[model samples]
Target: MRFLSSLLLAALIVEQVLGEYGMAHFSDWGNSKGKDYCIFFNSQWARLPQDLSKATRLQTYDLTSSVLCSPSDVPEGGFPNSIPMVMRGNCTFYEKVRLAQINGAKGLLIVSKDRLTPPSGNKSQYEEIGIPVALLSYKDMLDISKTFGEKRQVAMYAPNEPVVDYNMVLIFLMAVGTVALGGYWAGSRDIKKRYMKHKRDDGAEKQDEETVDVTPIMICVFVVMCCSMLVLLYFFYDQLVYMTIATFCLASAVSLYSCLWPFVRRIPFGKCRIPENNLPYCHKRPQVRMLILSAFCIGVSVTWGVFRNEDQWAWILQDALGIAFCLYMLKTIRLPTFKACTLLLVVLFVYDVFFVFITPLLTKSGESIMVEVAAGPSDSSTHEKLPMVLKVPRLNSSPLVLCDRPFSLLGFGDILVPGLLVAYCHRFDILMQTSQIYFLACTIGYGIGLLITFVALTLMQMGQPALLYLVPCTLLTSLAVALWRKELPLFWTGSGFVPPPIIMEQINCTQTPGPSTDEPPSNPEPATSETNNQREDPTPATQEEVPHLTDASNT
Candidate 1:
């Protein structure tokens, strides 16, 4: 159940505990004068006589590079009372640690060029080794060497990694609250649009709330694009990450504008039209308020882009933009039915599993592709993180700083994916006049799924495919509710939400076909009167049929 190695590097030594992997503090000198590093060792791999997990007093060790491999590799002087810094890949952990132990080293420090994994050895081999051995990143090695010479004295101990961070509460609030609010807005807007359909003749208003109904064909294409983009990002991250950043800036600007325009448009003062001109987008002379709002949104997006790397405040901006973007996406893209929701969530469930659990087998680094991309490649030259995720800094102090990402991340996909279903449930509830039963059920399921994801994340210590839990929880909860309510059929196909036009569309096929010529029909008066009578009949539309009429409107 061991997770991928940590992303922590930079001034601290990293140590992995025995049964569960946790961080250990690495410092130079007995007085904590130099940079912070971690002394990462697994008691399971290289057993230590004294419990290093509870280590408090500064146990200083003079570092030496004499024994870089087996005992044969020990230097001529064979310095006593020194911890030999072993180079990885020269030999096995047991041989190297045994060599160091025989050479009078107190402990062994192994420097690696790749991600840190526990030094592995069998029980018999562990019994043969008397000194503790731990893995150190090449970066930490370089920092140690540059700061203190080859023969440097350093103190090492683990301060106990917290079981959970309070930041999880903040993360939960941000995630759940966003989902709830977004779903509420989506449902309320849908109901408002329903009420406004016959009341307003403004095409612009119709266009504003219009959403792209997801089809089975579109679901396949979208998943394919997602898979391709993820792989491309994994392979070309250092270069493509900037492209992602730019895309985020642009998209987030639009999202911000979409989310804010409704409020800003009501300001009334800036309602004057831009002077009519022949410019491409300005030909119709859009409102002055829209222009100002657009500028403000763009500026905010650009500001976030420039300062995204600033861990302190950048995360706040990123979270805000990310939430707005998710809400906008939920409103813009329509799932149409529970079937579409299931299709999307299930496909992504498989996609997430393949990348996180299975891809490691195919990868050279033995690291999950999803984790690698999410955490950023360990060998990335750019050191740029993708802006697609919502970030929050870790609250508790341990070895993490909080690692490469000072903040814990929850991708927008995790929020928006299940969120789409949640929103669908809300719309369904409104359509059925069911008092939000489906909406509440699905949202609670989503919250539970998220908790399970967090619990699994802690237990596995690996980057989990959140959809693995979220999809099933949300989809099943919705399904169960539909079954209980005896509305599964209607919910599945969303027939209960269909617009009035579709019901009459059946009349077209049922009606007789007339002459296919430009000449007017001799009985055109009867046809026109029949249409008027049919339209007049629907005006007394009872409350019972309102649900079907409001199900879906012809675009």
Candidate 2:
């Protein structure tokens, strides 16, 4: 997952820069409605001129320097007092049309202000700017000039219609999502490998403790800076707000996942280490690939953050702390420390899919409700306001592309799985066969958390402060716990040693001594060299244990 993440980061950088630059420099379409090509003309038969009358017709042409060579070409510009040169200005067609109408002109005639190659197809450059405007092909303008001398009378009627483009938002969101998934998959793989090694070494074994030489603190600084810059961009960059937000959200999600997953078992911090005993040990090969991949993820995250802002140099310091914590969690997770990290990854994936796609779609669709109060006139002079109940959209269609409408794939059930996982983790060591009752409690508790997070984010997006929504979310977590009371004690007790199935079996059978007067062992031993030598030339069966889980998780 780590190597793949690096490849993905490289791809993300290339894809985004190329797409943005290419579209900006080469694509004819931009956010500028003032460009003649973006306009559309609508005229009736009565308004059509005698020579080239057409009704409800759509024609296209190129607008560039080559087509705007002379003033005589425009029928309206042919008047002796009138002159037509490319009129260059910065404003949308809507603004320009209003300006032209206010100046008492029948319509505005626009030609290319910049030199460029002609566009292809039946596309016409001339468009009716929203009020009786007329579009002209260069050829038409020239013909009008030759037949009627310098000027000809023309009229237009434009409307207040506006056009919207969501391409940028969609592109940015996709890029962010891809990068996030890459980071998570990569980071999780590394954690998984470490986990397997820890599991393998739990038995009788003695080995030298590996020295901690790497400076994870430095890497954390890099990642934190990246996250801080992304947050700033999302808040400050108005035009690219969607892109910035998407990037920030995805990066944060990945970072949290990377930092948390390894500790899914939640072993105490600063306690994990190689154990030593008389029994033989078998340590699987260290996952070099996962380590490299993790390093790459850290690098990409920091680099991206740095490039976004530099004065944020102070912000970079945050990554160092984050890196330290990530490394600690990474190391601890390798042992059968806690299931919390695993559960965290699962939770993050849940949040990612829903937050990025579902929630947005729901808000857009209006299936989610809001409350509004309005006063009606109170007397003969004023009516009384109606009772407020709920504010819902009349239709389910959302303007945003969040809910893959018509394809409606995910739903309330999807949210339940992760909740069940969390419940199961908390209920560790508990044995209950009552599926119906257990499932109902799980569903209700999970549903509440899901709903609370959804509402909190929605309110936050709509300008509600963190405190306002956070208070409610705290209650929601508390509720999930309260409703699922049957599982708590077992969860706490089960933490003694929740190893992998194989390791748990070995511990159960061997009757190992309890850690110093009832305390659990600080760390399990890694495989001894003697075991490695015995297994060195063993059949592929032994080799199978080497790379399966880590390799698969990374991919």
Candidate 3:
């Protein structure tokens, strides 16, 4: 599933027919007080005036003839000051509203069983009607009928939804902190890479060796996979959600182990290894503490999977694991140069925009494929959601909750795509001795980009392709820093600061023929390509020595 920014996740969950949300305050006219259930008011009709003093009286039309097409269906004197609830279908919304209005109904509540849409009407029809029109789901209608038999009063008023939810603050902190910390960690490790190499023994050495430096070719293939996987999930969500969950469980467990290994190694007590055995991969004497840590990480992921639906506390665990996963990826997947970083980030940028924006047109539901899959398919039988995103519950109570989207989401890709670049900057700074300037600039750029994304989210009210903003800001800021410091050439290629090769001097000496002290006379050593090596260490003669000096360039 795509990890996406879902500030207006309401687009998918809350289909605001008129781009407005209202709470259907249904109550007994006699009792005078009751619960308010959320409902949508159509923009085509008279908009609710937000004055609770004018509640429409609720009356159900005859069930058998629920379309209420005929004036005969109107009760004796008609619904004098009431709004009649009618079942959807069999007639146009305008026809239903007009018939209800002429029969003395104050408004119309069209109970719909399908997706919510506007009680649409032409401009001419708009002037011919005087009552409000709204949609109430069949489920809400049944609840109202069962809760209070009849004589119900309902008010439809749109409340101003708070554009800024407190959850945004939490999301900001989490996103910024995770990206910054990962960058700093990557840079620091790079600065001490040589020292670390000397200090690390068996397990740590293996861990260091496992990190894969990103390459230009690897990057293209990776983006293609991201696109393919996202599409597959969108199409086969039911079939793949299980595999996604299981993959996450396994992957997160390994990532968490990698993240924790540094700290675990310091424990000293767990450094002891088990005796050798022929039991498959572990036959090479594995560390006992490593095994224990592995089990704990696996346990956490499985626990999250089991209680994945527990909205109360499960999100905390998921976010914690997700952050570790991001950090682990930052460390393990090395970006070898600024060129590779640019290629990876830019390619993924296009990938995210295509999936999130362009796919809506291609989708039958008119919902973006990234958003549809990210939110979980509406028709899935399992109701299982992918746990790859960072989700935080909305901290305020608003009418928006009626949409069932109480959480704001940021996908792992959003964090990781930029994070990988930031990690490269840190390594760049440390290696080039630039005082972390590149790292800081890119990280700050990322934070600023995220801020812009949230702003777009608030104003536009839709899921945004985060990488669109993140890539430009990060890549440009880093490029600017390189230009300002006059290190663009070195930074772009990742050369200058790398340790010099010990054997290169010998090779150079052999290639360059200095003015001959003994005179290139005698036999001119004429044709001796082997004299290049003897020119340096003049005492070589033994077999091992013979191999060393003879064509040492090739050796």
TM-score of each: 0.75, 0.27, 0.74
Pitting candidate 1 against candidate 2, the one with the higher TM-score is 1
Local error of candidate 1 at residue 502 (angstroms): 22
| Model 2 TM-score relative to the real fold | 0.27
Query: Which residue pairs clash in candidate 3?
Result: 3-411
Question: Sorted on lDDT, highest at the top, how do the candidates line up?
Answer: 3, 1, 2
- Any idea how many clashes model 2 has? 54
Taking the tens digit of each residue's C-alpha lDDT, what string does model 2 give over 153-225?
3322222211222332332232223222322333344433345454433432222122121123423442344
**Tens-digit lDDT string for candidate 1 (23-51):** 33445444445555654576754443233
Rank the models by TM-score, top first. Answer: 1, 3, 2
Model 3 has an lDDT value of 0.71
Single out the weakest 10-residue window by summed lDDT for candidate 2: 15-24
Model 3: per-residue Cα lDDT over 484-512, one tens digit each: 99988877876545334464456546554
lDDT of 3 at 500: 41
